[model samples]
Target: MDYHTIRPHPDLSSIVKCYWTLEVPYQNDAQRQLIVPDGCIEMIFILGDDVKRFTSGDEYIIQPRDMVLGQITEPFYVLPSGDVKSFAVRFYPYGFSNFVSISIGDLVNKETPLVSLFGNEVATALADKIRSAADTLERIELVDAFLLERLITKPTVDGIVKRTIDAIFSTKGKVSINTIVNDDSSKRRQLERKFLKEVGVSPKQLGKMIRLQSALKMLLNNHTGSLTEIAYESDYYNQAHFIKDFREFTGTTPKAFLGDEGMILSSVFYKQD
Candidate 1:
C-alpha cells in the first residue's frame, strides 16, 4: 500500500485542505477495512478497480468512480474489489459548502456521485479529464481549475458557522457551544440550525470528532502513557468519557483500535500531519 498527501494551491488553501492519493495491490484474502469519521468531507475519484461499501451484515454496494463522501457520523467498512488506485480532495469541515448550493446535511454518511452534485454533463466532463490526466500532478491541476471556477461565483461561508468551526479546531474540540455563544439561547439555536445546514452535524458532534482525531494520532503514534492520560491530553474529562466518545465515532475501544487489522486505512490517514 502507498498513501500520501499534497498541499492545495495557495488561493484555495483556506477551503481546500489537501489532495491525496492511494494505491494498494490486490490481495487474495483482503479483509474489509473499517473507516471512521474524521470531521472532513472528500471528493474522490477511483482510478483503478471498484470498491464495495458494506451497507449491512454481509451486504454491500459498489461506490461510484467519482463521488463526494460527506461527513460520516459513525464507522463503516469498505473493501476494494481488486487493486486500488484513488485520488481525492480533503476539504475542511466548512470548506465544501462554499462551492455548492445543496444543503450539506443532505450529504451526510453516504457517497453521492459527482453527477448528482454538479450536473451530469459538467461532472462527467470533469471525471473524464481526471481519469485521462497523465499523472497525479496533472489531475490536481485539473481539479484545482474546476473548483476555482465554481468558487468564483459562490458566496462566502456564514460568519457564525465559520467562527464556530474555527473555535472547534483551535480548542481541539474541547470548546462548548454555550461558551461560544456566551450562554445566549437564541444565538445557540441559530448556530445549531446553521451547523445542520452548513456542516451536516451539530457543533458538539464536530467538536467530538476533532477531539477524537487528536486522540487517534496519539494512539497511532505510540504516545507514552495510559489511555486515561491520552484522553486527558485530548481534553476529555476522564478515561470513561474518552472511551465513550471513541466508541461513538470509531465503533471500537482505544486499545482495540491499535493493532487491529481493520484499521490499516484509518491508521495511515491519522498518522499524517
Candidate 2:
C-alpha cells in the first residue's frame, strides 16, 4: 500500500487543499476500511478496479469511476474489489460550492458522478483527458485548467460561510458559533442557512469534524500523553467527551484506533496532514 499527497497550484491554494493518490495491491482477503468525516469534499478518479461502499450490513454499491464525494457526516466503510489506484482533489469545506450550482447539502454522504455535476459531455471529455494523461503532473495540469475555466464565472463562496470556517480552523474548532456571531440569534441562523447550502454541514458539525481531525493527528502521531490529556489539549470537556466525539466521527475508540488494521489508509492521511 502507498499513499501520497501533493500541493495544489498556488492559484487554487485557497479552495483546493491538495491532490492525493493511493495505490494498493490486490488482496483476496482485504478487509473493509473505515472512512471518517474530515470536513472536506473530494473530486475522485478511480483509475484501477472498482471499489464497494457498504451501505448496510453486507450490502454495497460500486462507486463511480469519476465522481464527487460530498461532505460525510458519519463513518462508513469501503473495500477495494481489486488492486487500488486513485487520484483525487481535496477541497476546502466551502470550496466545491464555487464550482457547481447544486447545494452542497444535497450531496452529503454519497458519491455523485462527475457527469451528474458537470454534465455528460463535459465530464466525459474531462475524464478521458485525465485517463489518457501521461502521469500525475499532467493530470494535475488538466484539472487545474478545467477548474480555472470554471472559476471564471462560478459564484464565489459566501463570505459568512468562509469566515466561519476560517474561525473554526484557526481555533482548532474550540471557538463557539455564539461567540463568533456575538450571540446574535439572527446572525447565527443566517450563518447556519448559508453553511448548509455552501459547506454542506452546520457550523457546529464542521467544528466537531475539525476538532476531531486535530485529535486524530495527535493520536496517530503518538504525540500526546494520554486520552485525558489529549482530550484537554483538543479542548474537549473531559476524556469521556473526547471518546464520545471520537466514536461519533470515527466509529472507534482512541485506543482501539491506534493499532486497527482498518485504519491504515486513514492513518496515513491524518499523519501526513
Candidate 3:
C-alpha cells in the first residue's frame, strides 16, 4: 500500500485540510484496511475497482467511480476487490458542510451518492475528470478546478465553522468552548450545537484528540520524557487522565502502541502536529 497527500486549492483550504491518494496493486492477500476515527471527515473517489465499505454491519459499494463520504463517527473497513486505487480528500472537522446541503452531522459514517447532494451530472462529470487525469497532480488539479467551478460557497457556514476550527487547530487542542465563543453571549451553547451538527464530534472531543495527537508526536520524536512528562506537556489534567484519553483515542497504552506493526498506519496519521 502507498499513500500520499497534496495541498488543496486555496478556496478549499479553510475546510479541506488536504487531498490524499492510496494505491495498492491487485492482491487478494491484502485484505482491505479498516480505518478508525481521526476526528475529521473525508470525500473519496475510487479510480479503480469498486471500493467495498462496511459500517454498522451494513455493506455498501462505491462504484469504481466518484463518491463523497460524510464525517465518520464510528469505525469501518474496506477491502480492495482488485487493482485498488483511490483518491480521497481529508476535510477539517466542519469543512464538508459548505459544499453539501444536508446538516453535516446527518452524513456522518455514511456514504451517499454525490447526485443526492450534488446533482447527478455534475458529480459524474467531476468523478470522470478525476479518474481520467493522467496523474495525481493532474487529478488534484482537476479537483481544484471542480471546486472552483462547481462547489457551492456558503459565507455564513464558512465564517462560523472556519473561525471555530481555526481556534482549535491553531491552539493544538489547548482551547475550550469559551475560547472559540469569544464574546458572543450564549456562544458556548451555540458553538456546541453548530459544531455537533456540522462536525460530528463536539469541540471538546476534537480538542482531546488533538492533544493526544501532540503527545504521541512528542513521545515518538524522542523528546526524552516520560509518559507522565509528555502528558503534562500535552495539557492533560494529569498522568492518569492522559493515560485514559490516550487509550480511548488509540485503543492501546502508549507503551504498547510503540513498535506495534498493526498500529503503524494509525501512528503515522496521529503522531504529533
Candidate 4:
C-alpha cells in the first residue's frame, strides 16, 4: 500500500485537515483492512475499483464511488474488490457540518452518497470533474473551488465548539470536557446535544478517539515504549485502561494489532501522518 497526505489550501485549512491518497495492488484473496476511528469525517472518491464495507462477518455493501464517511465511533472492516486507488478530503471535527443541511448524526457509521447531500445534478458534476482531472493538483483545485462556494453560503461553526475542538487536538485529547466547557457546567448538556447533531458524536467520544490516535501513532512509530509508558504518554489512567479503550475501538489488543495484516493500511496511515 502507498499512502500520503497533502496540505489543504490556506483558505480551507480551518475546515479541512488534508487531502489524502491511497493506492494498493489487487490480490485474488486480499484480506480485509481494519479502519479505526480518528474523530474526523472524510469525503472519499474511489478512482480505481469499488470497495466493500463489512457490517457483519459475511455481509457488506459496496461503497459508493463518491461519498462522505461520517464521524466513526467504532472500528470497521473494508476491502477492495480490485486495485484500490482513492482520494479523500479529511475534515476537521466540526468542518463537515458546514457543507450540507442534514444532521451529521444521521450520517454516523455509514457511507452517504454525495448525491444525497449535494443533490444529484451538482454531485454528478463534481464527481465528473474529479474523475477527469489531469492530476492530483487539478483535483485539489476543483475541490477547493467547490468548497469555497459552500463556505460562502453555509453558517459558521459555533464559537465554543470550534475552540473546544481546537483545544482537544492541541492537547492531544488530554483536556477535560469541563475545561472544554470552561466550567460553565450548566451548558455541558446543551453542548453535548449540539455536538452530537453537528459532529456525529459527543465531545467526550471524540476525545477518546483522538487520544487513542495519539497512542496508536506512538506505538506504530516507536518500538521502545512499554505498554504502561505508552498509556501514560497518551494520558490514560494505566495500561489496563488504555488496553480496554483501545479494544473498544479496534476490536483487538494493541500488541496483536501491530503485527496484524489487517492493520497494514492503518499502520501506513499513522506512520505517514
What tens-digit string does per-residue lDDT give for candidate 1 at 122-231? Answer: 99999999999999999999999999998885448889889999999998888889988999999999998899888899998999999998888999887999998998
Q: What's each prediction's TM-score?
A: 0.98, 0.98, 0.81, 0.97
Q: Lowest-lDDT window of 10 residues in candidate 3?
A: 264-273
Residue pairs in steric clash, candidate 2? none
Is 1 or 3 the stronger prediction by lDDT? Answer: 1
Summed over model 4, clashes come to 0
Which is better, 1 or 3, measured by TM-score?
1
Q: Which residue pairs of candidate 1 clash?
A: none
- Per-residue lDDT value at 145 in model 3: 79
lDDT tens readout by residue for model 4, 95-121: 899988778999999999999999999
By summed lDDT, the worst window of 10 consecutive residues in model 2 runs over 153-162
Model 2 steric clash total? 0
Q: What RMSD value applies to candidate 1?
A: 1.0
Model 1 stretches with alpha carbons more than 4 Å out: 153-155
